[model samples]
Target: MAQMIVRNIEDSVKTGLKARASLHGWSMEEEVRHILREAVNQPPPARTKLGSRISGRFAGAGLLEPLPELHAQTIEPMVLGE
Candidate 1:
């Protein structure tokens, strides 16, 4: 088993942890270990791009053509206070 040391925790956070541990009938140390174990055991969420997600959502809606990408448009800066 690996030992870990965490420092500089806020007083309020420590108090909260103690309360949570008491609620679950565990020591503060046991509560922290349980929390850490659960955190590490869960799988990470998928990272999908916004464009791909939109395409997937509307895939069956009969939009077969891909949109052309716009290129090199000149922008006129706004003139403030005539």
Candidate 2:
């Protein structure tokens, strides 16, 4: 088994970790080891593209009427310190 040392952690973080360990009924070191295991072994999120994901989400729903043609609108630029 390999051991690791983490140095210079902030007091607040240490306090939070200690509190979490107490909540889980484990010592701080054990809590840290468990946290590391969970962090490493978690599965990666889906890699689907944003457009495909959005389309797929509404695929089952009926399509709406065709959208009207959009007309371009101009916006006045912001004037600073007026």
TM-score of each: 0.71, 0.56
State each model's CA lDDT, in order: 0.93, 0.91
Give the winner by lDDT: 1
Q: Report lDDT (Cα) of residue 52, candidate 2.
A: 88
Q: Which number leads on TM-score?
A: 1
lDDT, candidate 1, equals: 0.93
What lDDT tens digits, residue by residue, belong to model 1 across residues 1-82? 9999999999999999999999999999999998999999999889899999998999989978987787897778999999
Q: Native-vs-model 2 lDDT?
A: 0.91
lDDT of each residue in 1-82, candidate 2, tens digit only? 9999999999999999999999999999999999999999999888999978987998868887644666796768999998
Off by over 4 Å in 2: 50-82
Q: Least lDDT summed over 10 consecutive residues: which range in candidate 1?
A: 66-75
